[model samples]
Target: MAGRVVPAISLKDYESRREEITKQLVEAAETAGFLTLIDHGITIEEIEAQFALSKAYFDLPKEIKDKVPHNLTTNNGYEYYVRKHFPFLAVLLCPIKGPSTGSIDQKESFWLQRNSEWPSDEDVPTFRAKTLNFIGKCEDISNKVLTCLSIALGFEEDYFCKAMDTHQPDNLSQMRLLHYPASEGAQGTWRAGVHTDIGCLTLLFQRDGEDGLEICPGRESHSSFAVGDTFFPLPAETGPIVVNIGDMLMAWSDDRLKANFHRVRAKESGHSPDRYSIAYFNTGRKDVIMQGPLKKYPAITCNEYFLHHTKIQFGHNAKKKQEAAAAEKPSVVAATA
Candidate 1:
């Protein structure tokens, strides 16, 4: 595969270079559907501190982490591998295996939304305060990107910003902290499965040297599976945030933008190191209706769109779980006999 062609655009003098930045961002969205942002105002120190906090949270006992288990209604709090598919069941019971590898993503995540009730600071000192501060920085960058995209798509500069207003009670935007545990070259396993972000935009921060992120360029379908696509590596590098277009944004643009498939796979050779990354998902508020000027698709509320996408992503998994359960029933009956 060719080395990275994903554009790394600078946000330096953003006010002065709005037109140039907008052009570059729109171009990347149309082609690669992924790009990196440098000089975007968040310091390396701040990023590191947030990573530290993430580690501290993940280091806690499973029971402690489970205290804030992810809520399906709100899409916030802690979640283990494929837990979102069967919120009340264990991974063994609901194995949402990936199509290519037939293995579950070996990762856990903590999601935070604007109105999420954070984990107690007593568990991880200043976790709430520090995380909220970092989230604000991420939101600022996300809004700026949204502004650029708005202008590129011929909408008012604040159109997306207003639709995704952070202060709104129904806003669904989220900051996710992800941890992929170290593995001893587990065959068929992946840190994450191939999928596209479900929201409008995503800003991702990865720790240097923990590379596994890859993307399949030129994907035309909105489906998470890459049918005939080739994947290319996107190494983890500190400082710059990797940004990508998401399903909602593509729908909002009437397919002008792309939401490409991406994944984090296990290394083929040696042991795979533990991986850590943070992502800010910019989703429109629940009540906000999304439809581009071209109206190529049906107009839908953000909440309904999210539900439709979630069903597409995990509906098969639920069916598979039932089939697996049925297949195991005979064995259990014989063993009991």
Candidate 2:
């Protein structure tokens, strides 16, 4: 069977045409698990400006970037690919690793929350103010999307928004600035591994001519890590933002929605250009419990479910490394003897 085509929905006149938009969004979420959104209130110029700022931040020296290392507890700050390994406890929460490759993702990222401390003006002058402003814009879009999803699920329009309230101290919604450096000759490495996002919804912005995003939508309903043999390319372009459902929403909708497997594969020629993209992950407050009205799945708190889902998604990589270390220990003893 042919793969589903990702639908594009317009957010123009959203206030007046909300019911129509909600149906389209829910249909896309149910079938393709992804969609392209246009006229979503954010301008192309604003997106490019944020992309430029992201490049400047990633271009800084490693030492400077390291100043604001990632905090496992808060899930904020810079994370370089080379130093991607997490503390034993943190490994349970880090879900970027690829199950097939048994290696870390090739890209680096800077995670930002509303309350996160900004980089100093000396390092990047406009970074703080511009980024926060952009985040607010993205949040506006997110809230609108969430409102639609809530109405589709037979709840009040503000139901999901209240659960993901940014003002809450434990809100987990965040924006990420990602940089996938050019891989001119690297082989057997993925820019990003195959996995489903753990949040409720994700808004992704990508540049033109830098295509690598692929999705296996046929496996959308699969509960495990298995994927279909055929994959479909979801090219990156300007103007429209790519939006997708995530595990949290899938569960919240009692499988009525999908959170399909996706990844960034290397080009056929083994060469890839530098790729920069921005992602806004909208998650519920840590204390909020998520479960569908139908009660198909057990209710679980946001943070607890995140950890549980990541463990199922990336736990094998940790176990694989441990086994390899254990196997090498006997050889080292023999060499010493």
Candidate 3:
């Protein structure tokens, strides 16, 4: 299935429709694994303002932006497009016959980590405070979502909330802003490659009119071939913030809930305007381990699991290439001989 749209799952008056909304949430998580959220508490104006602020940062000159190079390890600061970071694009989009020429597609992004080190600049003096303010709202929504999931699983309302309390150290979730430049005729390129998120859940906002996000159901859909017919545009962002279960949630649910594969296009055929999105990746402390309420899964700390596994999902091909190159290199013994 492409994606489901569940209307007005109220964040207010929870006592009124707790079971009703819980059923919708669980059904979407199990089936489509992706859903458009409405009545999520964050207002359209706030959403617009956040996007505008992100746009301002993104519009700054390249030299100015480069002041903060990305921290690949933590995914903090700015990142210039590198094909390997999005492995599925290399495998799928690059081969589609466009400007890519089998190389990485270009996109730029900024990641904001809660209470982590941040860059200060005169250009966007208010950037830090405003962004943080928006993220605070995002965290509240995510917490309520955790509660809903607990209800869906037939557990006490606070079961998941207590398990993933953000106040605890190492559990800080993050928000990321993405900018996809308008692409003309391209050989083959992609905005984001096919991959599943490693966090507990992801809340995505597509700038009002832009379209490029695509998703495929189930974990297996991330592989090369399955991406063709199965992939479809996520419902447009109008009044709906698309939400999906991520890998952590999948493991915690013993795979009862899914973390579906999703992607963004490198170019939208002939689109002229840039595409922007804000994504909140919901997760617990890094130290938190992957485990289910039923104890049906083995435990691995969130950081350890995502580092070894998430990178593989994003750049499995790149890793394979490195391995191949290493194996093919002539040994010192052979060279000396």
Candidate 4:
């Protein structure tokens, strides 16, 4: 089966259906690595507003958008990574390349992290405030799902919740706004490259028929890319948000749940020119340490594992130690407001 849609889940009435919900969640995570969430309490109207905000922000003049450059030290703000300007080191592992490996993923993004600087409401009137509420709702829903996942793994309901420390001051959870422009008939190009998320869980919102997302299910190892791996097209229903397991959760489950590899517009599937989506990554508090329930993996701070994993998977040039420290420390400086 392609990506399946789990029934609507309610945090308020959680216990009544805990067992059933846990079973479904576990099965999907172990086999499909992707699931759609329905009746998640956050309405489609609310999500559409967030999507509109993403569009408004990206539509800004180049000067206004570039003012907020996303970099290693400041993990938030706008990132304009023209596929042509990519560094050689970063492209070594990029599977599909043109005349040069650097020119592969053509995309633009805006990242918002917990307690990080945000564009003022004046810039995108009421966006900063509304989006914060959207983030809160997503975090709440993610915690509820984590609760069920813990039960599925035979741990206390709050085991994963406590490890996430969602309310902590230095939480690394983020809600990212992404826009993938049309390929313009550009061959051998993608909106985003093949990569796995670096978190415990990711809640993704995409408008139906505005599709480009693809997944290689059950393919976890970064070094190996197989042609026969299951490449599934996402179910792009208008009402539901997609959810997937990430590296941290995969490690926490001792590889029972795989960190699925995915890419956006990686093929000539005739995707729409304008694609917009929101991804809320539950990276957990940088200080919260994690290990598999069976001690199958060594304990490491969330921050440490994230940076280390990104370095190996994406070949990021940042020093691991410095990146880990940057994740925890309060802003001495920020890329933008």
CA lDDT, every model vs. true structure? 0.81, 0.78, 0.68, 0.70
Give the alpha carbon lDDT tens digit for every residue of 179-266 in model 2. Answer: 9989886653577766788889999999998788887675444255555445578988977999999888888898889888777766
**Alpha-carbon lDDT of model 3:** 0.68
lDDT of 4 by residue, 1-337 (tens): 4524233333435668777777777887886678777767888788788888889998888788877677566467787764422355334434444433344456788888657777767677887788888888987888888998887777788877776765666567888888877655555365776667878899999887777787767554423334243456774556687889888888878778766777665345443467888899887566667777787877777767877776655554446436556665463321110
Which regions of candidate 1 are displaced past 4 Å?
A: 1-4, 83-102, 221-227, 316-337
User: How good is model 1 by TM-score?
Assistant: 0.87
lDDT (Cα, tens digit) per residue for candidate 3, span 1-337? 3534333345556558767777777888886678777787888998998898889889999887777776554556787775544434445532343333234545788887866556575877688888889888887777777888977766678766665665665554778888888878642356666567878788888876677787776453222233343566764565578889887788778777878776676444455457888999887555655666677766766655665555465553445534543454342321100
Q: What TM-score would every model get versus the actual structure? A: 0.87, 0.86, 0.81, 0.85
Per-residue alpha-carbon lDDT of candidate 1 for residues 162-245, written as tens digits (9 for 90 to 100): 888888766789999999999885753567766778899999999999989988777664543433446789989989999999
Q: What lDDT does candidate 2 reach at residue 333?
A: 12
RMSD of 4: 5.0
- Error in Å for residue 132 of model 2: 0.8
- Looking at model 3, report the run of 10 residues with the lowest lDDT sum: 328-337
State in Å the error of residue 94, model 1: 22
